[model samples]
Target: MEMSELTALLTPEGLRLLDALGTVETTDAAARAVSTLRAAGHGPDLVAAVVGQAHLRAKARTKFGEFASRMLFTRAGLEQATRLSVAARHAGRLRTAGITHVADLGCGIGGDSLAFAGAGLRVTAVDADEITAALTAFNLAPFGDDATVLHSTAETADLTGIDAVWLDPARRTAGHSETRRVAATDYSPSLDWAFDLATRMPVGIKLGPGHDRDQLPAESEAQWVSVDGSVVELVLWSGALARPGVHRAAMVVRGGHTHELTAPADSEDAPVRELGAFLHEPDGAVIRARLIGDVARHLEAGMLDEHIAYLTSDAALTSPFVQSFRVREVLPVTPKAISAALRAGEIGTLEIKKRGVDIDPATFRKKLTLRGPNAATLILARVGSKRHAILADRVDAA
Candidate 1:
């Protein structure tokens, strides 16, 4: 939003209107609201701002939950903001470290700052983007002086007496509705500066889970977090924030359950063996943290392929770190042969998963005409030097 548009929306009349409008979940509802507001003689800027925020609030629910209702957001800000649950976890870490005041550098939409203040820590939330800073101030307005929102670059923000720091450097070009990835060298606050600050005090830096593991600092603890199977972020912790005897960690959160796997160093790969009664797919965070070996050992499983992440074992075991599947039978590798086998079983619903294979699951699914009431999972994997097609059933842990 433009500065002038934001100026019109910060007033009492505008926020009340936004609250009254609620969320516009559909394009038709959005158009109706815009027309009604325009008919009521509201200025174009105020109408646009309220309508846009209403739309954003609807979209923000997935990340911010109910709190999104009272918060203002830009499209890009909402996209980059950390999920509330994850932010709260970060806040707990700082609190456990005995940090009283923390500086959140490049605080996009104040996600971490909100968590910090809510966890009873004083926060200095700084952002280089003027509009994002203003929205953050509004989001954290409830905390009053406990949360200080600043419209300044992280490099220029005064640290003063802060005990801990959180850095979320911009990895994309500045934008509102659309953004593209930029080279990490162009990141605001620079990795060099952020890493340097970590040496003096506890610091946490958030990066994409797929970030180059080789480029990570040797002195920090890297934690890969996955929510509901998707690997979300890789956080590097330094100083007291870094746990002792832990250089690599994987935090998997599914629904209300949370599990963590940590190791002092990269784990060795489990020995490869032939397919057994059950197959296991390590969670994305486990794969990213290179801790699959630990999970495999826990389940008494071995790698199905020397290079692939899939695991297999004769024992019927499962854990939060892996999605377990019961191997039904080995099927023919060709799509036509697979289709014939699927049709013979009257399987209508199929979940196709592929690894170390060149086939597109979607296109291959279309090739098979499913018509029965049965449902099954199809795993296409490369075992040793051979490609194998296996029918499997998802194991529901008891």
Candidate 2:
């Protein structure tokens, strides 16, 4: 959004209109709301800003929950904003480390800064973009003097007395939408500068989960986090912010429950064994953290393949780190043979899961001629270079 539009949005009349408009869910509804506001003599700029914000607030519910309603967001800021729950965890870590003051460099929309303030830490939230900084200031207003928003680059921000630093470097293009990923070396403030700052003070850096592991600093504690089955981001903690004796961690947040596995170093891969009665799929966080072997050891399981993350065990074992499935039967990897097996098993609906293969699940689903009275999950994987289709039933955690 333009600075003029933002200035107008902060005005008394604009605030009143935005408060009255509530949330506009659908595009049709937003269009109608915009038309009504225009008919009421509002200018196109004001109408457009309020209507766009209404839709953004609605979408922000997934990340910020109720707090989103009172906040303004830039399209790019909201997309990159950390989920409140996840931010809360970051805040807890800082609090636990005895950090009283934090400098949130490149604080997008003040999401993490808000968490830091709420955790009772004095926060200096800085964003280089004028509009984003203004929006952050608005979002953090409720905290009064506890939080301060600044419009400046991370490299230029003053960090003299800040107890710790939280850096979220701009990893994508400048646009609000249609943004493409930028290389790590090209990150705003640069990874080099960020890492240097980390050594001088306790620091936490948030990066994409798929970031090249080889480029990561070995001295930092790296944690991979997954929320509701989707791997989100990798966080690097340095100095006092890094947990004691924990160099690598996988945090899984599912159904409001949080679980973590930590190790000092990468765990060895479990031995590959024949298919057992049960198949286990490690959480994405665990897989990304390279701690799948640790999870396999906990479940008394072995890897299905040396390279694949799938695990199997003879006994019915349960763990928060892995989803257990009861293997019913093994079918031939060929589509025709798999279709015949499913038909004979009376499986009408199928959930196809594949790893270490190139087949698209959607296309493969279309090829299957399923007709029956049951539902089953089909796991297509390679065992010692040989492909096999395993039918299994999901075992829900009790």
Candidate 3:
């Protein structure tokens, strides 16, 4: 649907119709609401506004009903909702680290702040956008009056004496669509300013997983969090907030159960193993935690390479941080040979995963004309080089 049509369906009359209908669950409800508003002779603009507003409100409520706060509707704000599990895990870590108060810098729509308050920490939430700050107040209103929302950039925001600070730098411009021209340094509350704030307060900053390692401070602990096997966000913690090291953790919440994969700080010994019947690739978090070696040791498996993170064995192994898959076949990396092998086996549909391979999955899929069979192949590469493909059946762990 056009944005204009969407806006027209979001009018006062449209909102009234929606409210009268209670909550929207079907497209028919949306269509009927639009039809009713249009029949009532409501202008297109009001209709559109009401529809848009309802959609946003419904989305916010659906995603964040557990916490109360206003919506910022920014890219970063959306990312927060998407990474809620990661935020909650980070909050748990902070609680363990003895942080009872948090100064949430750039608190767009109060995403992380909600998690902080949910963790029972006092929060002083700050944002640069006036509307966002107001929305933050509204979103945080349901927390039973313990959260304070502020409208100001971190540079000028008063953060003195707060136990911890959460910083998420704005990565977009006001106009919204000109991101190609926007720069990270252009944030009103710059990273330099955030770093300075970290020195005085326990600070946890949310950054893109692809952020430069050089940009990270030498004394900070950097964590990469993934949910359901998908890497989502990278968190940086200062000494005041956490101990120094490269920490990687998978924040898994399955069926109301929560688990994490963390490497012990003291264990540096790698795993030793002889060839086994199956190889297990540790989860990203376990790899990031630098504990795959420990996991290998725990499983009595050998590393394919000291630097490479893949573990191999002839015996069955059990670990939370890795998935065990039985090797069906191994082949040298070649387009024609791989394609012929796939075609000869009548394998039509395939999932190609590569770690060290230089070929893009999309490009390889196109080149091989893969289709017909249901199978998944893992393309392991050298530590820094790409390895050939390993066609395998995923071992059901549970």
Candidate 4:
């Protein structure tokens, strides 16, 4: 949302209209709402703002749940905001540390701030962008005096009264609607500054899950989190927020339940062996946290290939940390041969999962010309020196 649109939306009239409008999720609904509102003598800017917000609120339910209905968003802010479930976990760390006040630097749309305040802690939320800060203030207005919203850069935010820091630096270009990711070196309130702050205070630093591990501070606890199979973010905890003797952590959240795997440091890879009855694809968080060996031992598994992350086990075991697949049979890697095998199996829908290969699953799925009354997952991988396609049935996580 632009400053002009935001200015119009701040009016009492605009907020009421946005709430009354419900959800304009479809293009047709948005268009119709705009026309009807304009026809009712509403200004174009107000009409646009409320309609846009309605769409964003509907989409944001995936992250903020019902809170989004009463909140506002910028396309970029919503994209970068942490999920409520994950943010609550972050707040739990602060609560456990007995920190009562938190300074949330770069508080995009106040997502984490909401979690903090909801946990009964006072929140000081800061954002560099003026429009975002204003929107954040409005979103957090419900918390009243408990939440302080600031339109200041992280460097300028006063933290004297704070107990801990939650710094999520802007990792994208400055914009309301359309924005692109900036390089790590270009992050606002640079990582260097953030890490320096970490050394002195209890801090939780959120970064992209794929952040260079070697660049992370040696003393901090690095944790990778995934939600329902999608790796979300990497968090570095220092001071009171860091767990003792725990250096690498993988937190997997599925169906609102969480299971965590932690190690003192990255674990060595399990020895390689031939394909077994079950193939385990470790969760992305597990792979990124470099604790695959811990999970491997838990399942009595070995690396399918020395250089790949896929694991194989003769034991019929599965864990929350991996998506286990019952390997049916290995088929030839050639497109024609693989398609023939799939067709003979009566496969109608295929899920292609690949690692250590250069094939695009979408294009390859089309080439396979799937047809029939069955669905199966195809595992494309390099085992030893050769590439192979393994037909498999997904074994739901226990």
> What does the lDDT read for residue 16 in candidate 1?
94
Q: Which stretches of candidate 2 lie over 4 Å from their true place?
A: none
Count of steric clashes across candidates, in order: 0, 0, 36, 0
User: lDDT of all predictions, in order shown?
Assistant: 0.92, 0.91, 0.65, 0.93
Task: Give lDDT tens digits, candidate 3, residues 140-249.
Answer: 77676679998887878776668778888775665211243246677557778877767766888877656666677656677766566655666778866666444444
Off by over 4 Å in 1: none
TM-score head-to-head 2 vs 4, winner: 4
> Estimated TM-score per prediction?
0.98, 0.97, 0.76, 0.97
Question: Which ten contiguous residues of candidate 1 have the minimum total lDDT?
Answer: 175-184
The digit string of per-residue lDDT tens for model 2 on 320-398 reads: 8888899998988778988888888899999999998888889989888799889999999878878888999999853
Model 4: lDDT to the true structure: 0.93
Clashing pairs in 4: none
Identify the runs in model 3 with alpha carbons over 4 angstroms from their true place: 1-39, 43-45, 57-76, 80-82, 175-188, 243-257, 263-276, 288-291, 305-309, 334-349, 360-387
**Better by lDDT, candidate 4 or 2:** 4
After superposition, the stretches of candidate 4 with alpha carbons farther than 4 Å from their true spots are none
Candidates ranked, most accurate by lDDT first:
4, 1, 2, 3
User: Over all chains combined, what TM-score does candidate 1 have?
Assistant: 0.98
Q: For model 2, what is the alpha-carbon lDDT of residue 224? A: 96
lDDT-superior candidate, 3 or 4: 4
Model 4 lDDT, residue 150, Cα: 90
